[model samples]
Target: MIIKVRLIPTTGRNEVISRIGSVLRVKIKNKKVDDDAANAIMRTFLADFFNVHEESIIIVKGAKGKEKTVEVRDKSEEELRKIMDSIP
Candidate 1:
Protein backbone atom coordinates (compact mmCIF):
# COMPACT_ATOMS: atom_id res chain seq x y z
CA MET A 1 0.00 0.00 0.00
CA ILE A 2 0.99 3.60 -0.49
CA ILE A 3 1.34 5.97 2.44
CA LYS A 4 2.34 9.56 2.96
CA VAL A 5 4.97 10.70 5.42
CA ARG A 6 6.19 14.06 6.62
CA LEU A 7 9.93 13.57 6.95
CA ILE A 8 11.81 15.80 9.36
CA PRO A 9 15.46 15.33 8.52
CA THR A 10 18.54 16.20 10.55
CA THR A 11 16.74 15.66 13.84
CA GLY A 12 18.55 14.57 16.97
CA ARG A 13 17.33 11.02 16.42
CA ASN A 14 15.56 8.78 13.95
CA GLU A 15 11.98 8.22 15.05
CA VAL A 16 8.42 7.71 14.03
CA ILE A 17 6.75 10.63 15.72
CA SER A 18 3.04 9.78 15.39
CA ARG A 19 0.14 9.04 13.12
CA ILE A 20 -1.31 12.38 12.26
CA GLY A 21 -4.46 11.33 10.47
CA SER A 22 -3.19 9.90 7.15
CA VAL A 23 0.41 11.03 7.44
CA LEU A 24 3.23 9.34 9.33
CA ARG A 25 5.52 11.92 10.87
CA VAL A 26 9.14 10.79 10.92
CA LYS A 27 12.43 12.31 12.00
CA ILE A 28 15.87 11.36 10.76
CA LYS A 29 18.75 11.63 13.19
CA ASN A 30 21.52 11.76 10.62
CA LYS A 31 22.87 15.15 9.67
CA LYS A 32 21.61 16.45 6.36
CA VAL A 33 24.77 15.83 4.36
CA ASP A 34 23.01 16.15 1.00
CA ASP A 35 19.77 15.32 -0.77
CA ASP A 36 20.85 11.77 -1.66
CA ALA A 37 22.18 11.24 1.84
CA ALA A 38 18.91 12.37 3.33
CA ASN A 39 16.93 10.05 1.09
CA ALA A 40 19.22 7.13 1.80
CA ILE A 41 18.91 7.66 5.53
CA MET A 42 15.14 7.72 5.22
CA ARG A 43 15.05 4.52 3.15
CA THR A 44 17.26 2.52 5.47
CA PHE A 45 15.75 3.89 8.65
CA LEU A 46 12.22 3.29 7.53
CA ALA A 47 13.13 -0.20 6.32
CA ASP A 48 14.38 -1.11 9.78
CA PHE A 49 11.48 0.60 11.54
CA PHE A 50 8.89 -1.21 9.45
CA ASN A 51 10.72 -4.56 9.41
CA VAL A 52 11.04 -4.62 5.66
CA HIS A 53 13.86 -4.68 3.17
CA GLU A 54 15.26 -1.30 2.20
CA GLU A 55 14.63 -2.23 -1.41
CA SER A 56 10.93 -2.57 -0.71
CA ILE A 57 10.48 0.98 0.43
CA ILE A 58 9.94 3.16 -2.59
CA ILE A 59 9.97 6.93 -2.29
CA VAL A 60 7.33 7.64 -4.87
CA LYS A 61 7.29 11.38 -4.29
CA GLY A 62 9.16 14.11 -2.48
CA ALA A 63 12.53 12.43 -2.74
CA LYS A 64 14.27 15.73 -2.13
CA GLY A 65 11.39 17.30 -0.22
CA LYS A 66 10.06 16.91 3.30
CA GLU A 67 6.67 15.46 2.46
CA LYS A 68 7.11 11.99 0.96
CA THR A 69 4.80 9.43 -0.53
CA VAL A 70 6.07 5.89 -0.04
CA GLU A 71 4.91 2.69 -1.63
CA VAL A 72 5.16 -0.71 0.01
CA ARG A 73 4.49 -3.42 -2.49
CA ASP A 74 1.68 -5.98 -2.12
CA LYS A 75 0.67 -5.00 1.38
CA SER A 76 -2.91 -4.03 1.97
CA GLU A 77 -4.44 -1.50 4.33
CA GLU A 78 -5.69 -4.23 6.68
CA GLU A 79 -2.26 -5.80 6.84
CA LEU A 80 -0.66 -2.49 7.70
CA ARG A 81 -3.26 -1.88 10.37
CA LYS A 82 -2.53 -5.24 11.91
CA ILE A 83 1.18 -4.53 12.00
CA MET A 84 0.75 -1.10 13.54
CA ASP A 85 -1.68 -2.50 16.09
CA SER A 86 0.95 -5.01 17.14
CA ILE A 87 3.50 -2.30 17.79
CA PRO A 88 3.56 -0.85 21.24
Candidate 2:
Protein backbone atom coordinates (compact mmCIF):
# COMPACT_ATOMS: atom_id res chain seq x y z
CA MET A 1 0.00 0.00 0.00
CA ILE A 2 0.99 3.64 -0.42
CA ILE A 3 1.48 5.94 2.56
CA LYS A 4 1.59 9.73 2.37
CA VAL A 5 3.98 11.27 4.87
CA ARG A 6 5.00 14.73 5.96
CA LEU A 7 8.57 14.41 7.22
CA ILE A 8 10.13 16.90 9.55
CA PRO A 9 13.89 16.68 9.29
CA THR A 10 16.56 17.86 11.72
CA THR A 11 14.37 17.58 14.76
CA GLY A 12 15.60 17.16 18.32
CA ARG A 13 14.29 13.62 18.28
CA ASN A 14 12.86 11.16 15.77
CA GLU A 15 9.28 9.87 15.75
CA VAL A 16 6.30 8.92 13.63
CA ILE A 17 2.69 9.97 14.10
CA SER A 18 -0.25 8.40 12.31
CA ARG A 19 -3.38 10.49 12.45
CA ILE A 20 -4.75 10.36 8.93
CA GLY A 21 -5.38 7.07 7.26
CA SER A 22 -2.30 5.63 5.56
CA VAL A 23 -0.33 8.79 6.19
CA LEU A 24 2.59 9.40 8.54
CA ARG A 25 3.99 12.42 10.27
CA VAL A 26 7.70 11.82 10.82
CA LYS A 27 10.56 13.62 12.43
CA ILE A 28 14.11 12.55 11.80
CA LYS A 29 17.11 14.11 13.47
CA ASN A 30 20.20 15.28 11.59
CA LYS A 31 18.90 14.17 8.27
CA LYS A 32 18.94 16.12 5.03
CA VAL A 33 15.90 16.28 2.77
CA ASP A 34 17.85 15.34 -0.36
CA ASP A 35 17.77 12.44 -2.73
CA ASP A 36 20.57 10.36 -1.24
CA ALA A 37 19.91 11.18 2.38
CA ALA A 38 16.14 10.78 2.25
CA ASN A 39 16.36 7.48 0.44
CA ALA A 40 19.01 6.15 2.77
CA ILE A 41 17.24 7.32 5.91
CA MET A 42 13.87 5.99 4.74
CA ARG A 43 15.39 2.60 4.10
CA THR A 44 17.20 2.44 7.40
CA PHE A 45 14.32 3.80 9.42
CA LEU A 46 11.78 1.40 7.95
CA ALA A 47 14.06 -1.56 8.44
CA ASP A 48 14.85 -0.68 12.02
CA PHE A 49 11.38 0.44 13.00
CA PHE A 50 9.21 -2.06 11.18
CA ASN A 51 11.55 -5.06 11.17
CA VAL A 52 11.09 -5.19 7.42
CA HIS A 53 13.50 -5.32 4.51
CA GLU A 54 14.76 -2.09 3.01
CA GLU A 55 13.41 -3.00 -0.42
CA SER A 56 9.85 -2.90 0.88
CA ILE A 57 9.94 0.85 1.33
CA ILE A 58 9.84 3.05 -1.76
CA ILE A 59 9.45 6.79 -2.14
CA VAL A 60 6.68 7.39 -4.64
CA LYS A 61 6.65 11.20 -4.27
CA GLY A 62 8.33 14.12 -2.50
CA ALA A 63 11.74 12.66 -3.05
CA LYS A 64 13.32 16.09 -2.84
CA GLY A 65 10.90 17.65 -0.34
CA LYS A 66 9.70 17.17 3.25
CA GLU A 67 6.24 15.95 2.28
CA LYS A 68 6.52 12.45 0.82
CA THR A 69 4.37 9.70 -0.54
CA VAL A 70 5.83 6.27 0.18
CA GLU A 71 4.95 2.85 -1.13
CA VAL A 72 5.07 -0.07 1.28
CA ARG A 73 4.65 -2.91 -1.12
CA ASP A 74 4.84 -5.93 1.20
CA LYS A 75 2.98 -4.79 4.31
CA SER A 76 -0.68 -4.72 5.25
CA GLU A 77 -2.37 -1.65 6.76
CA GLU A 78 -2.70 -3.24 10.18
CA GLU A 79 0.92 -4.30 10.15
CA LEU A 80 1.96 -0.80 9.13
CA ARG A 81 -0.08 0.72 11.94
CA LYS A 82 1.62 -1.53 14.46
CA ILE A 83 4.97 -0.34 13.25
CA MET A 84 3.93 3.29 13.43
CA ASP A 85 2.62 2.83 16.94
CA SER A 86 5.85 1.15 17.95
CA ILE A 87 7.91 4.22 17.05
CA PRO A 88 9.33 6.09 20.03
Candidate 3:
Protein backbone atom coordinates (compact mmCIF):
# COMPACT_ATOMS: atom_id res chain seq x y z
CA MET A 1 0.00 0.00 0.00
CA ILE A 2 1.04 3.59 -0.53
CA ILE A 3 1.12 5.97 2.40
CA LYS A 4 1.71 9.67 2.72
CA VAL A 5 4.03 10.60 5.53
CA ARG A 6 4.91 14.01 6.83
CA LEU A 7 8.35 13.55 8.27
CA ILE A 8 9.61 15.64 11.14
CA PRO A 9 13.34 15.55 11.30
CA THR A 10 15.27 16.51 14.41
CA THR A 11 12.73 14.91 16.66
CA GLY A 12 13.64 13.45 20.01
CA ARG A 13 12.73 9.98 18.87
CA ASN A 14 11.47 8.07 15.90
CA GLU A 15 7.77 7.49 15.77
CA VAL A 16 4.86 6.92 13.42
CA ILE A 17 1.38 8.24 13.83
CA SER A 18 -1.35 7.15 11.54
CA ARG A 19 -3.29 9.94 9.90
CA ILE A 20 -6.46 8.69 8.34
CA GLY A 21 -6.01 5.24 6.77
CA SER A 22 -3.18 5.54 4.33
CA VAL A 23 -1.28 8.48 5.66
CA LEU A 24 1.27 8.61 8.42
CA ARG A 25 3.10 11.25 10.39
CA VAL A 26 6.68 10.14 10.93
CA LYS A 27 9.17 11.72 13.22
CA ILE A 28 12.82 10.78 13.16
CA LYS A 29 16.07 11.94 14.56
CA ASN A 30 17.52 14.72 12.41
CA LYS A 31 20.81 12.92 12.27
CA LYS A 32 19.09 10.25 10.18
CA VAL A 33 17.60 12.62 7.63
CA ASP A 34 20.52 12.64 5.28
CA ASP A 35 20.46 10.57 2.09
CA ASP A 36 22.38 7.59 3.40
CA ALA A 37 20.91 7.83 6.83
CA ALA A 38 17.37 8.13 5.50
CA ASN A 39 17.78 5.06 3.38
CA ALA A 40 19.11 3.05 6.28
CA ILE A 41 16.34 4.17 8.56
CA MET A 42 13.73 3.42 5.95
CA ARG A 43 15.11 -0.03 5.45
CA THR A 44 15.28 -0.83 9.12
CA PHE A 45 11.85 0.61 9.81
CA LEU A 46 10.16 -1.35 7.08
CA ALA A 47 11.96 -4.58 7.68
CA ASP A 48 11.24 -4.59 11.36
CA PHE A 49 7.69 -3.30 11.16
CA PHE A 50 6.36 -5.36 8.29
CA ASN A 51 8.81 -8.22 8.47
CA VAL A 52 9.61 -7.51 4.89
CA HIS A 53 12.83 -7.10 3.02
CA GLU A 54 14.42 -3.68 2.98
CA GLU A 55 13.93 -3.56 -0.78
CA SER A 56 10.17 -3.52 -0.34
CA ILE A 57 9.85 -0.01 0.98
CA ILE A 58 9.96 2.62 -1.69
CA ILE A 59 10.04 6.34 -1.13
CA VAL A 60 7.86 7.75 -3.84
CA LYS A 61 8.20 11.37 -2.87
CA GLY A 62 10.21 13.78 -0.76
CA ALA A 63 13.41 11.88 -1.22
CA LYS A 64 15.31 15.04 -0.30
CA GLY A 65 12.97 16.53 2.26
CA LYS A 66 11.49 15.88 5.63
CA GLU A 67 8.09 14.87 4.32
CA LYS A 68 7.62 11.85 2.12
CA THR A 69 5.10 9.60 0.48
CA VAL A 70 6.07 5.99 0.50
CA GLU A 71 4.82 2.97 -1.38
CA VAL A 72 4.94 -0.43 0.20
CA ARG A 73 3.14 -2.78 -2.10
CA ASP A 74 1.53 -6.10 -1.16
CA LYS A 75 0.61 -4.95 2.29
CA SER A 76 -2.66 -3.87 3.83
CA GLU A 77 -3.31 -0.78 5.89
CA GLU A 78 -3.52 -2.71 9.10
CA GLU A 79 -0.25 -4.42 8.48
CA LEU A 80 1.32 -1.12 7.58
CA ARG A 81 0.15 0.45 10.79
CA LYS A 82 1.55 -2.40 12.81
CA ILE A 83 4.81 -2.04 11.02
CA MET A 84 4.92 1.71 11.56
CA ASP A 85 4.01 1.39 15.20
CA SER A 86 6.91 -0.94 15.64
CA ILE A 87 9.31 1.84 14.72
CA PRO A 88 11.35 3.14 17.59
Candidate 4:
Protein backbone atom coordinates (compact mmCIF):
# COMPACT_ATOMS: atom_id res chain seq x y z
CA MET A 1 0.00 0.00 0.00
CA ILE A 2 1.15 3.53 -0.71
CA ILE A 3 0.68 6.10 2.03
CA LYS A 4 1.07 9.85 1.99
CA VAL A 5 2.64 11.41 5.05
CA ARG A 6 3.29 14.96 6.17
CA LEU A 7 6.03 15.07 8.78
CA ILE A 8 6.19 17.76 11.42
CA PRO A 9 9.58 17.81 13.07
CA THR A 10 10.79 19.02 16.46
CA THR A 11 7.56 18.30 18.27
CA GLY A 12 9.37 16.76 21.26
CA ARG A 13 7.92 13.33 20.47
CA ASN A 14 7.20 10.99 17.61
CA GLU A 15 3.59 10.19 16.87
CA VAL A 16 0.84 10.13 14.32
CA ILE A 17 -1.03 13.32 14.89
CA SER A 18 -3.91 12.73 12.52
CA ARG A 19 -5.00 11.40 9.15
CA ILE A 20 -6.87 13.43 6.60
CA GLY A 21 -8.08 11.66 3.50
CA SER A 22 -5.07 9.75 2.19
CA VAL A 23 -2.53 11.80 4.10
CA LEU A 24 -1.19 11.11 7.59
CA ARG A 25 0.11 14.00 9.66
CA VAL A 26 2.98 12.86 11.86
CA LYS A 27 5.26 14.63 14.31
CA ILE A 28 8.84 13.79 15.25
CA LYS A 29 11.06 15.15 18.00
CA ASN A 30 14.57 16.64 17.57
CA LYS A 31 14.99 19.99 15.92
CA LYS A 32 18.58 19.24 15.01
CA VAL A 33 17.92 16.00 13.17
CA ASP A 34 18.64 16.15 9.45
CA ASP A 35 16.38 14.95 6.68
CA ASP A 36 17.86 11.47 6.54
CA ALA A 37 17.59 11.06 10.29
CA ALA A 38 14.01 12.26 10.23
CA ASN A 39 13.17 9.81 7.49
CA ALA A 40 14.79 6.96 9.39
CA ILE A 41 12.85 7.87 12.50
CA MET A 42 9.65 7.93 10.48
CA ARG A 43 10.40 4.53 8.99
CA THR A 44 11.08 3.02 12.39
CA PHE A 45 7.94 4.45 13.93
CA LEU A 46 5.80 3.35 10.98
CA ALA A 47 7.28 -0.12 10.93
CA ASP A 48 6.28 -0.65 14.55
CA PHE A 49 2.90 0.95 14.02
CA PHE A 50 2.15 -1.20 10.98
CA ASN A 51 3.72 -4.29 12.52
CA VAL A 52 6.15 -4.63 9.67
CA HIS A 53 9.89 -4.68 9.27
CA GLU A 54 11.69 -1.37 8.69
CA GLU A 55 12.90 -2.67 5.32
CA SER A 56 9.31 -3.10 4.23
CA ILE A 57 8.70 0.63 4.29
CA ILE A 58 10.23 2.86 1.62
CA ILE A 59 10.05 6.57 1.00
CA VAL A 60 9.35 6.69 -2.70
CA LYS A 61 9.12 10.49 -2.91
CA GLY A 62 9.74 13.72 -1.05
CA ALA A 63 12.73 12.41 0.81
CA LYS A 64 14.13 15.92 1.28
CA GLY A 65 10.85 17.61 2.09
CA LYS A 66 8.25 17.51 4.85
CA GLU A 67 5.79 15.62 2.68
CA LYS A 68 6.61 12.02 1.77
CA THR A 69 5.13 9.19 -0.20
CA VAL A 70 5.73 5.82 1.40
CA GLU A 71 5.32 2.38 -0.04
CA VAL A 72 4.49 -0.41 2.37
CA ARG A 73 5.08 -4.00 1.35
CA ASP A 74 3.51 -7.25 2.56
CA LYS A 75 0.22 -5.60 3.50
CA SER A 76 -3.07 -4.98 1.85
CA GLU A 77 -4.96 -1.70 1.75
CA GLU A 78 -7.77 -3.07 3.88
CA GLU A 79 -5.33 -4.38 6.45
CA LEU A 80 -3.58 -1.02 6.63
CA ARG A 81 -6.88 0.74 7.01
CA LYS A 82 -7.77 -1.48 9.95
CA ILE A 83 -4.46 -0.84 11.59
CA MET A 84 -4.78 2.90 11.06
CA ASP A 85 -8.23 2.87 12.55
CA SER A 86 -6.84 1.33 15.71
CA ILE A 87 -4.65 4.39 16.31
CA PRO A 88 -5.90 6.96 18.80
- Tell me each candidate's TM-score: 0.80, 0.72, 0.65, 0.88
lDDT of 4 by residue, 1-88 (tens): 9999988876577888888887888888846333888889999998988989999999999988889999988888899989777655
lDDT of candidate 3 over 9-69, digit per residue (tens): 6557666645545556666666656476875676577555566777778888888766677
> What's the lDDT of the predicted structure labeled candidate 1?
0.76
lDDT (CA) per prediction: 0.76, 0.71, 0.67, 0.85
Model 4: pairs clashing at backbone N, Cα or C within 3 Å: none
Question: On a 0 to 100 scale, what is the lDDT of residue 75 in model 3?
Answer: 68
List candidate 3 segments past 4 Å from native. 18-21, 32-34, 74-88
Pairwise lDDT winner, candidates 2 and 3: 2
Model 2 lowest lDDT segment of ten? 13-22
Model 4's lDDT to the true fold? 0.85
